[model samples]
Target chain A: MDAFQAIADPSRREILRLLSRDTMTINALADNFDMSRPAVSKHIKALDSAGLISIQNIGKERYCILNQEGFDELQEWIDYFDTFWKSKLKKLEMLLNEKAGK
Target chain B: MNRDIVHRWQFRQSPEIVWEHLTKPELLSQWLMANDIKPEVGHKFRFTTNPLLKFGFDGIVYCEVLEVDPPKRLSYSWKGGPGNGKIALDSLVTWTLTLKDGGTELLLEHTGFSGMKNYFGYLMMKNGWGSKIRKRLGALLAGPGK
Candidate 1:
């Protein structure tokens, strides 16, 4: 699934939120939620496929860490919205000034 | 655990000019906010933004300069407000100025954000700092003046 789709679910978002702070092992992460280990593992897998999180083998355990590179696409999308509103507001302000003969 | 955001801008001015504007009260007020800054380490200051009055930190960035290397780097501690019952959420904001062929490259990093754990705080900080640095500061530096 895409990044947006993967983060749409609250469970997945929570997993990402936790990962954003620091890396955690699968068992440590599973302990935070009431879901079973398999369910948590599925959420982690979906996030991993989306390139939002990466798993690294540390000793015998695997740790999941946030990979912010995926958010660049999202940031670019938001930047467009920011530019659009800024220009639109500037045009509206100019129109209002002209009407007021300023 | 370095949860800091770094932003860089290349300005068409000398490092001294950029540094002056960054540290001077009048120039900083135009872009950053209104504050009484002495440009000395341990000097306390407060920045007030009218919009921040509602959420309580509009221009309420209480800070103290930690280090100042002229035309190069400046580091300061950024606190939220009065030190009574406040959680003392402090961050280190450092600015490094490098002389470039065209002009000067200003690099800013806001680190040590251990207290911004909540979603709303994080969102507000992301939007607020991004706008101030990318837009307002850019406009000020691009304006006709040293």
Candidate 2:
């Protein structure tokens, strides 16, 4: 699942917002949702599997925080395209310059 | 939005000349990649490069020109993957050129993701993160932990 898939739902987006400022325990995150806890958990699981968030256990609590993994997927795409196009365009610029010089 | 890449660049040249670099195969290969690209709409072409086997890509970005409006607008279908009919991404690449500042303003839009599924799969495979994704998927299927 990509970052887009992870945040594809309103609930998931809300969950991300809830965790955006700081890490929140699973229970704490669930209290904000109107849906059943299991449904909320399902969303959490989806987000987790999609690498949007990380679930870490501190003692008996499962804390959730925004993870860089999925965002990195997005960033990777942007970076690759940025580099790909810039390099090609640079070459084109040089080629055009050469033509102008000639 | 949603994985679409939009880029803009300025070229100190006429749209006619910039358009040539975009359409002519020899000129395109000098800047982009080796290909048999043409300005004709519906013309099929492929940009070939070194194979990236790790990503299951044969290094051939198959494309088909979709629209061409000489020196103004152009669009094409960009498809690639592990060959043999399997594709990781089925995207559209569109280019628009505007005459401004006595130069050409080139805009590129690569869209058609998020509406599809295989792109994430392709990226995951390309990044060699399949094992980690599988682990996460397993955890998801096992239901949430208490």
Please tell me which predicted candidate would have the highest lDDT against the true structure: 2
Window of ten residues with lowest summed lDDT in model 2 chain B? B137-146
At residue B55, candidate 2 shows an lDDT of: 37
Residues B26-137 of candidate 2 have per-residue lDDT tens digits of 9899889999998898899999998765334578988999999999999999887667766655678899999999999999887663212454344445444434444543
Model 1, B1-146: lDDT tens digits are 22445666666667887787668887666555688876788888877655332222333677899888898998888776323435324567788999998577878776655332333234334434333323322321231232
Off by over 4 Å in 1: A1-102, B51-58, B81-85, B116-146
Docking quality class, candidate 1: incorrect
**Fnat scores for every prediction:** 0.00, 0.24
lDDT for every model?
0.63, 0.74
